[model samples]
Target: MADRLSQVSGHLTNSYGRGLLAGEVAIITGMCWRSWSGIGRSAALLFAKEGAKVVVSDLDEKKAQIVVDEIKAAGGDAIAVGGDVGADDFPQKVVDAATKKYGKINHIVNNAGFTFDRMLHTTPDDAWDVIQKIHVRAPFRLIRAAAPHMRFKVRRENRSVINVSSISGLHGNVGQANYATAKAAVVGLTKTVAKEWGGFGVRANTVAFGFVKTRLTQAKEEGASIEINGKKVALGIPGAKDDPNAQYPHIPLNRGASPDEAAAGILFLASPLASFVTGHTLEVTGGQGI
Candidate 1:
């Protein structure tokens, strides 16, 4: 069974909901349709169900709106703000919209990014730059843009910011030199922000994922693709030469994580449950590193 937090699972509409995030305003980047949708979308929806008003960002405006619509249909309040997170101006636009719509920003999830796999000596400069821009630079800019808004609410509420990393970044992986570098950079950035923002009561953390079931994990032969910065890029789990499912059997859990299951750790970091936690990297790998 999938984790309840991963599913709607009586949490959103159920009377049993903890309302863990009651009265919070959240901004989740990369939450929409297509490749970047999995974890970001689940986090957005889960946050809303916990009583947050969300501002969701995606590269595709229409795709962003689709997720926004789903939130509203479920009786939650949300809005779509779409743009390339790698762009210099896009982060500010997303932060501005969230504050304008919700009166303040309390949570930010810098989950917008994609993998560009290649060996170090063979990777193209474009691939290296694109991966870095999306994974490292984008999150840095978004957090920088959202921090000021969150500070204003620091005394009133425990503001939180969460960045998404991956197992490839943690233990390192073949054919992912670019992703591994950027994600490792994210660990440093997350810890730095935690110290800088802690005095203001803002908690910053990174949720490093193992293998979550998403288009990124699909076998290359599945022919999955995503449009990023207007270029079609291959989307897959990186090491799959044959069966994509081959990687899962090696996982300690003996299964890949559901999107919602991956998101559950993120929500905890973003919610009051992790009020004292910051500068921490919560590995959601089902003991993959062990």
Candidate 2:
């Protein structure tokens, strides 16, 4: 499955040998654990293959080290930095680590985030605050820290910022009020940062993803099979078990996207291909909302 997915990705980019991101350094957050491997790992590998050095950051040291090991085994340049995104000093720490190792920071992917399932009335205040801190506060702080570094790089080399948002933010989902609010704020941050930093050759944008198979989705699928809150809500579509294409019958594309597909969109926005693109939200949902 991994090999097949790689082939699909190679064909999708079609610029494997061009080195579009050559000499660049990208920091990817939320890249720990098997569930996040698809998007975060794929992005790290792809960036390296394109001649960019990578900084893989995650809250889980073990998982983050695994990603770094994989990249190194592939003969790519990378390092793992483990720290909680919700930490007050995490942003500065991330920037410091990236600069110390790579000597410069060029791109950032704000992807580290998760949310506990709870409806508004059922959510506790602590849970709401934690969700917001992780999803919104952390990303914004990281961008703020990276801004000056990016500016310095631009004076010497251009840079970009890719913030990961969600469809839940665009069209709210039940039991995701706090998560949605945080993600929506990310979109707003993306635009504002793009506008403020454009002159410095720093571009910012967001990627809003829909259903994608990951550890989180798998857990949700398992939980959905059993009754929750006195309701049997099917996490996955009825026929998705056998036919992957059956998952999104209502979507124009009729299927969910792979993590690599989402990563490709991030790469595009970060590359010269999107030199003039900023403050945009690229939906990697197979046309689900359209």
lDDT, each prediction: 0.82, 0.78
Writing each residue's lDDT as its tens digit, candidate 2 over 170-196 gives 998888898889889999999998998
Q: What is the lDDT of residue 254 in candidate 2?
A: 71
Task: Look at candidate 1 and give me any clashing residue pairs.
Answer: 6-260
lDDT of candidate 1 over 213-246, digit per residue (tens): 7767767677787766578888785455443355
**TM-score for each model:** 0.88, 0.84
Candidate 2 stretches with Cα past 4 Å from truth are: 1-18, 153-156, 221-245
Off by over 4 Å in 1: 1-18, 32-37, 152-156, 238-247
Cα RMSDs, all models: 6.3, 8.0
Q: What is the C-alpha RMSD, rounded to one decimal, of candidate 2?
A: 8.0
The number of the candidate with the highest lDDT is 1
Output the lDDT of residue 157, model 1: 67
